[model samples]
Target: MLEVGQSTWRHLTLAQRARLLGRLHATVSASAEEWADIAATSKELEPGHPLRGEEWLGGPYAVLTALEAYRTSVRALAQGESPLARVRTDAAPGGRLCARVFPLTAIDGLLLSGYSGEVWFEPGVTEAEARRNAGLGQLTPTTPAGVGVVLGAGNVSAIPVLDVLYELMASNRVVLLKVNPTQDALLPVFERALAPLIEPGFVRIVRGAGDVGAYLTTHRSISHVHITGATPTFDAIVWGPGANGERRRRANRPLLKKPITAELGGVSPIIIVPGEWSTADLRFHAEHVVTMRLQNSGHNCIAGQIVLLSADWPQREAFLDALRVAYEAAPRRSAWYPRSDEKLQGAASDYPDASWCADGTRALIEIGAGDDATALETTEYFAPILGVVSLPGTGQEFLDAAVAHANEKLTGTLGANLLIDPAAEAALGDGFERAIADLHYGAIAINSWTAFGFLIPTLTWGGFPGSTLQNVVSGMGVVHNALLLDRVERSLTRGPFRPLPRSVSALAGPGRFSVLPKPSWFVTSRTGATVSEGFTRFRMDGNWARLMGTLVQAFRA
Candidate 1:
């Protein structure tokens, strides 16, 4: 299959490739409900369960958004223009070029008003360098280079699909995808959605356990590999397993000769800067934090595992109390991932003083200064075990401390988030941007969750550059960057503090305000499922009526 694809793939024109993607977009949209159903069934989310929204927004809707981004980019290339041709660029704090990704279309401005995001290039990448180097492979697609293998992720349905699209569109390679065993039930839906590529022999989907993966990885035709699983799996494939693996690692001898990339889970952090807040502010952010930690039953690789707070802040206790309320408020879902139930029990047994939900599905441990946070900082617990640490200082001092701690203490550099009040943020001024520049993370968010980097197609998703094979912090390389940017340093996003209605307060001026409602992706949303369904349909056809219906659901949520 690889040999045949390479033979015919390069012969097809850019317009032909774009049309193939267009066909894939339609079929995937048609199968969106079945894909969501597969995900819902995985976690035992029965019909009419409010958490069904998790399947739609996080599962199918996310893939739909990626398809739209990639389709647009490919179409642009077919029209003799680079994907970055219409993009606006500016200088960050260090003169490194910043690509303005959000609000690329008029609809973006209306849908996510008051939101701003940018991708900061590596140091010394001037604007010209950035533009000229953008869309490296596709800008000069002379041939379909080779075959790549994608080891799909079990936790998220979109990971494998997006990876396949990246290999085909960005790298100009055909793909042979192997779905994780945990998500094998969704194989039929994936096959149906990807029929366009499958029929043309441009893409193929296979299923199996460890042996199947080992077979494909060692195949003579496979030129590159990518995985969205655990770090141990990467090490096992790169080096031999068990004692021999450690020996090979110590001697700098790897078993695999080909290049591989990954997006492994990490102990992500959420820093809450000290500031004055109204009652509504605490409640809103409390639920926001809950969504960050418990979304998809905390199976997300970018889930918020640790939260940093200021010990001297007057509202620390109040916000913590609010968080407790929010945690207990969310309904329980089954732990379908391997050993998730045992992991949840482990959290309760490990931390005696930890508070838990009624069903023990969520655990919160409070760690004061000098308390041991070894497990929280170094380990990526698959269960919903949240750790709260109180650092010293306030204002810019606290911000600096939080950045230093997250960079120096946390195990992985995949993602980190900061939540600061609008007024308090204005007070920080230059110190705030400086702190963001200093954080050693692939993706950073302000007043938002880092998972946004995963959903946004233009933003590069990976860990901070510098991790080696021996100590793979958050794995290596990147995907889902539809812009095909090179020398990407990190993705930075800032959003409105509150949702609509309350967001109309005096603080929400034109310069900095978002009219977005409580997003349907929020687990606590009342109409999340309905809103996500509407958004999925809207993405399918871009119909005005469908969008109005989705807006109604969002407002209700």
Candidate 2:
């Protein structure tokens, strides 16, 4: 299957590629409900629960969006225009180019509300260089780079499909995707949805355990490899295991020579810049913090694990109290992802002083100040455990110290989030912007959760670029960058301090300008599935009736 795809993919013309992507878009749209159902069942989510919306967005909707973007790029290429010509670009500091990719139309703004995102090219990437390298492998049809192996992630259903899309569309490579054993129940669904690529011999989906993955990774026919998994897995694959792995890593020797790229997990942080706050503000952000930790049952790589707070802030205790209330209010979700229980147990054992909040089905362990090398700070607890660290400083001093800590002390450079009151932001002024510039993360979100950077297809998702085999912190390379810009350093997504009317933000407060019926990300909401599906449909087709229905459902919740 891989050899056939390797041979046939190179011959596909731009028009043919566009058509193939269009077919994929149709397949996903048609299979949306079934796909969502399978994922919900696998994750133990109730059939009609709003949390099923997570499956829809992370599964079919994500694939459909990527297909549309890839199709647009290929179609533009066929029309003799730059694939990135539609993007608006500006110059950032150090000669980097910032390309605004989201909210491409006014309809996007109307649908998303108060949200905008951009990808910054690497330093010294001029406008001309960006335009020149925008399409890279797709601009002019090139020979296939042989069969590529994609080791899929078990947590997010969309990740495997999107990884396949990136291989085919961005790099013009054929793919052999190995589904993670944890979620291999969806093999039939993948076979159906990816039939277009399979029929054309451009892609192949295989179900597998670790042994199967090991065989495929070492196969001579496979020219390159990409994985969305942990750093240890990458190490085991590239440098053997245990003592030998450490030896090879130190000697900079890799067993597998073929090029490998990965999107690994991280201990993501949310730096809260202290400021005066109203009760409404506190409530709004309390919900925001809870959503950040509890979303996807806390299995997400970009979940807000470490929350940095200012020790001198007067509202610190008030905000913490509100956070506790919000956390307890959210019903415990099923820990369905692989190893979630084990990870949670490890965290509990390491920090016996940790405050435990569990109702059997879900858990939220809070760790207070401890040594920097403690498990709570150093380990990527892929569960509902959040560590709160208080730093001394106020205003710029706080922001500067926080930035330094986040950049240096955090485990991975995958992504980070910052929550600051608008007044506090105004007070910091240029210092806030400077602080943002200094964050050594692949994606950063301001006044919002970092998950937005991953959810938005246009934003480049990966580490901050310079990782190697020996020091693969968050792995290497980028994905989900629809625009195909070269040398992308990071993605920064900014949102309004307060929720906009009709916005689906988790940060919406009691009296603030909120228009949603209920927060779609909340697993406790009875109508979560309906609201999620409605919002997704509205985004895909912009149907007013669906939007109205979703709003009504939200209100009912």
| Alpha carbon lDDT of each predicted model | 0.84, 0.80
Candidate achieving the largest TM-score: 1
Q: Write the per-residue lDDT of candidate 1 for residues 1-557, one digit (tens) a residue.
A: 76687667777777777777788889999999889988888888899999887777767777777777777887887787777889988878766788999868777677667777799999998877787777767776766669999999998888899999888877888899999998899999999999888877778999999989988998889999999888999999888789999999999899888988888878889999998888998998988888898988888888999999999899999999999999898878866789887777777666777887847668989986566888778878877888998899999999999999998898889989889887888898889888999999999988888887787777888888887888887878888888888888999887888778767763634225657778777888999888777777777788988798778778888
The local lDDT score (0 to 100) that residue 83 gets in candidate 2 is 69
Residue 540's lDDT within candidate 1 is 79
Candidate 2: tens digits of C-alpha lDDT, residues 1-557: 67877677878888988888888777777777888888888888876565678887777767776777777777888888776788889987666788988877665565456678988888888887887787767875766678899999998898999999898777878899999997778888888889998987888888879889989999988989999999999999999889998898899889888999999978888888888787877887887888788888888888889888888988889999988788777766677777888988887677666666656443444544554435666788878887788899889999999999888888999989998876688788778887888889999998767777787777789988889888899989999987777899999988765653433334443222334433556555667677768766765676897687777777776
Roughly what TM-score does model 2 have, to 2 decimal places? 0.94
Error of 2 at 480 (Å): 0.7
Cα distance off (Å), candidate 2, residue 145: 1.0
Runs in model 1 lying further than 4 Å from the true structure: 506-511
